[model samples]
Target: MPTHGVIRRFNDTRRTKEKMTPGDLCLLAHFYGVSVEVMALRLEDLNLLPNGNWGKLKAGGFRVREAQQQLGLGPLPAR
Candidate 1:
């Protein structure tokens, strides 16, 4: 699915107006086929703070390159 579509789905599933919780981040990470820690790191790189709790975060606020870098996966393959 497209990135926006995935994010929309995640937001819909979350059903919250606040930032995403840690569990929400976990589920979002699963949706993107990555680990929660990696997702957290990516969020951090994106300038989104992830407090060491069930803290919330703005969804769909990061890019694939940020996530890849957090996972040490390098740049994305050219289309």
Candidate 2:
């Protein structure tokens, strides 16, 4: 795990905006215990976000907020 200073430097906004370098990629890969190739997959390269309800999304399902307010649906059913 990175110390506070290292993490802070990575997120500092005062610094000029720059693209992630190869070293940054390696750091993230090691942190997540994943390969550099996997870490390199940008969000633009993905059709849908991971760990989300892709089944519902693909079938044109609405999110909780949309279903509740716009469609006037009840709260989510019990698990």
Candidate 3:
């Protein structure tokens, strides 16, 4: 999908302004152990996993809020 169209579609379905970008896609690919092409296609088709009552977003890249949960990672302690 075109960049503009992707943004528009993302906005339409998402209630928040936080939409995935190319950079995010790259990270998601790494976290999910998938190719960029696969991730991008999933984003474009909105079929990465599945949609339902759950707040399962097919978003690219890891949002700051979900970084830990998505990757089972934790934030570093403050010095």
Root-mean-square deviation of candidate 1: 10.1
Q: Supply every candidate's count of residue pairs whose N, Cα or C atoms clash at under 3 angstroms.
A: 2, 0, 1
Predicted structure 2, TM vs. truth: 0.34
Q: What's model 2's lDDT at 20?
A: 44
- Report, for every candidate in turn, its global Cα lDDT versus the true structure: 0.54, 0.40, 0.48
Please give each candidate's TM-score.
0.43, 0.34, 0.36
lDDT, candidate 3, at 20: 56
> Least accurate stretch of 10 residues (summed lDDT) in model 3?
48-57
Residues 25-75 of candidate 1: C-alpha lDDT, one tens digit per residue: 656666667656666666555445445332233354544445445555543
lDDT of 2 at 25: 40
- Give the residue spans of candidate 2 off by over 4 A: 1-17, 42-79
Which candidate wins on lDDT? 1
lDDT of 2 by residue, 1-78 (tens): 234543454455225455544445445444455543444443113421233323434356424344234433344334
* Ranking according to lDDT, highest score first: 1, 3, 2
Residue 28, candidate 3: Cα error in Å is 0.5
CA displacement after TM-score superposition, residue 21 of candidate 1 (Å): 0.5
